[model samples]
Structure formats: structure tokens, C-alpha cells
Target: MNGRFDLNSLPMCGAKTRHGIPCKRKGNKKNGRCKLHGGHATGAKTELGQLASRANAQKDFPDWFFGKPVKTEYVIRALSSYEKLVELMLADEIDWDTVFDVVEQDQIPLEMLKYYIMFNVTPEALIIIQSALDTYYQETHAPHLAFHVYAPMIVFHKFFRQLSAPDREYLANWFKKYSSRHPGYNW
Candidate 1:
């Protein structure tokens, strides 16, 4: 078997085209016809089939963070830094240049936070989310607890405090497990 992967190498459908050309579509072993022709399955077309197809397509998506979609890992880590930077900025200890750099770097989170207020996400929720995310981030170097999970969390935050006790306990466990992963939150 040559390493080439051209149509000539595979078994072709025995059917003929309107122009009398041999069917170039791959044939199924049972009936020698591709799905387009007369293969056993014709693909998902019904409502249930379509829903199943969509669910299969979505199988790779990560689970929601507190019922909110999370930003990518890099954005999350930077946002953790952004949270810390903001505190240092408020203290007026960090230079403006450094503070601006971090803020500019975390554009995704900042923008989401900026406009989310218009949609009714109170600054109070923002405080809780940031603290949680930053804590998770520092603890594991894998901060996913918060930051710009964007619309999902923004929408979910309204119900943040009312989450099931088990979910809250899970988060509490994460904090306990890695409480001092980072050096004392300094600098």
C-alpha cells in the first residue's frame, strides 16, 4: 500500500453518475454506496437527531464555572494579576506605569466588568468573584474561579450567594487545599 491518500486508492461506489462517470464517492462495505447515495445511515435530520448532533458537537466545551462560562486560561491568570495590581494601585504604592500595563493587559476582563454593570451585575458581585478567582489562581497557578467568564458568570452572579451548599462547599474546599500556594500575596 502506497502512502498516498487519493480517491483512486479507496473503494469507489459502483453507481454511475448522470454523465456515466463512475461514482467517485467512497462506498460502504455492505452496499458499496456512500452516505450521500444509499449508505445505512443518512445522517441526523430529525429533531431528536439534530439535538443529539448538537450535543455531540458541544462535548468538548469546558464545564461552566459556577454556571458561568470561563475565559481561556491565559486570560484568567492575567486577570488574577490584574486583581492584585488593582489593590496595589489603590494603595498608591505601585507606580502608575506598572499599574496601567497590567490593566491594559487584562482588557477582556475589564471590558466585561465595565459594561456588565449596565446589565445589573452589581459591583458587590464583582468583589466576590475577583477575590475567589484570585485566591484560586494564587493557590494552584491555575486560577479559574473568576475573571471574565463573561456573560455566563455575569448572569449567574445574581444568584451567586444562593448556590447549593454543596457547590459552595466545593469552592471552600479548593481554598483550604491550596491556601498558601503563593507567597503571602505580596508585591
Candidate 2:
């Protein structure tokens, strides 16, 4: 049985574009893409993608300055530190200058943050990154930089959230077990 309906089944709106294809499929009330292309623009490719591509294409970091060091242990340690740094940044507001001070005093470079963001970043990391930026702004009372970072952070967060699975299964399981364990939320 053809479960689908024809486009003609719906009311016909005046054609917007001859070249532009029908916005809705036949008999299918929900809107969909035309024959040629896939579904509508997902809004996945954002200005950040353009900026990253432009920056990377335009400039190359010094090899030793950016890439993993010769010592495997150092590379591993640096990676671990990178995760810790991101987590810490997300957990609370912090002094950017204080962080840099530690880096300088310890002889560790601040470029590490930049590199981690650049190379190993996933969409989830952007949340922490934006939090870190907010933390910096809150600590320093700098609205200017915070304003700049906000857009990219929001964009990345939206994209990531869309891709993430809802905790439906986990929550369902939890509720089932939870109700069995405790009958009421209130004592």
C-alpha cells in the first residue's frame, strides 16, 4: 500500500519560483525539499566553519609550536591537562589573567588552549568554551569579548544539541526503577 499521498491533495498556493521546486510533496501535508536536492538547509554550516577554514587556510602555526612534542608522554600529559583545563573553565568563573599567569610561571604556553580548541574540538566542547569565555567576562567585567564569543558558542551549542539523543531511554528506565524504589516525590 502506498502510504504517501499526492501533492495535489493539498490546496495550491501560487508558485513562488519556476526554477525553485515545490516546497511541499504531493499529498504530503508536511513540507519537504524538492526533487533535486536533499532536505532543506540544516543550518549546520555556519559562519564559524567559514572563519575556521579561512583562518586555517591563511595561516600555519609553527610546527614545534603547535603539533605534539617528540616525547609521547608529554603529548599524553598535555592532552590530559587540556581536558582538565576545559573542565575547570566550564565548572566556574575564572581569571583569564590568573590562568595565563600560571602558564607563564610554570613555563607552559597559553597557546595550548587555542590548539585544543582548534584541533581536537567536538561540538560539546563549545559549551565549556563559551562558559569559559563567560567566566572570563564575568571575572574581568569585559562585555566586549563576551559579546564576540557568544554567537559562535550559541551556534555550536544548537548544532550539538540537535545531534544529541534525548535521555528518553535512560529517563524511562530511571523512572521505572525510581517509582518502584520510592512511591512519592514528597514524604
Candidate 3:
């Protein structure tokens, strides 16, 4: 035998048997874990890459604007609303004397007082609301607008009581005053 000896007892060298290194099973085209786990392993990554590409297609705005530009068409359209809101917000000075008289004597609901002054809800309303909240805090030592600072959706389920004692106190007092003295209420 030309000095080459085939040892059948030596675990079958490259044995041509079903268990010999599992012979790259029939449908295992890409190797590694057969057809089940080997198909390029990238569909999700490719989809994410495409998504990122699309997202990056637009020029990013300044980081301060939260990816939104300052001069979008909506801003232009809201200019008039902004003006109206501001006008409504700062139209008149608060008359503490009248407020006290109404509260102490007239026994009117303060919310009624709020409607007397037109309060517009628009982009401009933001500043007005802020100013109102600030003034309420200053006058009553309480917070008037609790949900204004947080995402509106998130604040829905929470009450101002969840805030710090001082914040809660302020909001409560301010709301009380607003509901009692503001003459512009609709209801």
C-alpha cells in the first residue's frame, strides 16, 4: 500500500459521513448558522441608515431651537396672532383697589374678572401667560401656571400638589385670586 494507510478506527478522517463536520448542510449558502441566521444580518441596520439619511437631508437648525428654524412659514402666519395676544395680555394695569372691592364686597367669582381682559391662546399667548404667572407669583407668593413649564401631555395626569410646598402654595393662592377677582370669566 504505497506507504499511505487509511485508519478506519481513527474517527474517520474527513469521513464522508453525516456527522463529519456537518458537511455545510444543503441550504446553508452563506455558512455560519446555516440559512436561518446568516443572511447578511443587516436589514434593520440598512433601514435605520436610510431613516438617518432622510432625517439628515434637511439642514439642521440651531441646537437652541430644538431642530426648528426661527423663520419658518408658520412663524410668519403667527405674527398677527402674536400681536393680538400681546395686546390682550398687557392691555390694562391691574387695579388692586377694584380687586379688593370685588372680592370683599361684590362677592363676584374671580374667574369672571379674567374674561374681562381678552386672553388669546397662540404663540404670542406664551409671553402673556408667562407674565401673568409671574405677576401672580409676585402678588400672591404662589405659582399660577403649573403646567406651563412642562410638556403639556406629561402634566395632564399630575396635579400642582406634586410640586414643592412653596410652588403648590403659590399656584393655589394665585389660582384662588384669579378665580375670585378676574372679571373676565366666561362661565
Worst 10 residues of 3 by lDDT: 147-156
Misplaced by over 4 Å in model 3 are: 1-88, 92-121, 143-187
Count backbone overlaps in model 3.
20
lDDT of 1 by residue, 1-187 (tens): 6776665545778677788877778876667686667645667864334535654675434333335444565446545755555565557364655544554455345444432432454455455435433544464475343333323334444544555677667666655555556546532
TM-score computed on alpha carbons, candidate 2: 0.23
Give lDDT tens digits, candidate 3, residues 1-187: 6677543322312213455454333333224243433456553354234434444554232121232232333233334433443555555865544333332321111222222122333334444534543454566665433322221111112222345676567666665776687667733
Which regions of candidate 2 deviate over 4 angstroms? 1-69, 95-98, 105-117, 121-187
> Please, what are the lDDT tens digits per residue for candidate 2 over residues 1-187?
5998665666543334466755343222344334333345543364344444544563432221223333344345445545665755655675567544333331122222433443466646545544544555566564433212211221222233422243445545556776787877632
Regions more than 4 Å wrong, model 1: 1-68, 72-75, 113-153, 159-187
**TM-score between model 1 and native:** 0.26
Clashes of each: 1, 4, 20
lDDT of each: 0.52, 0.42, 0.37
C-alpha TM-score for every candidate:
0.26, 0.23, 0.20
- Which TM-score value belongs to model 3? 0.20
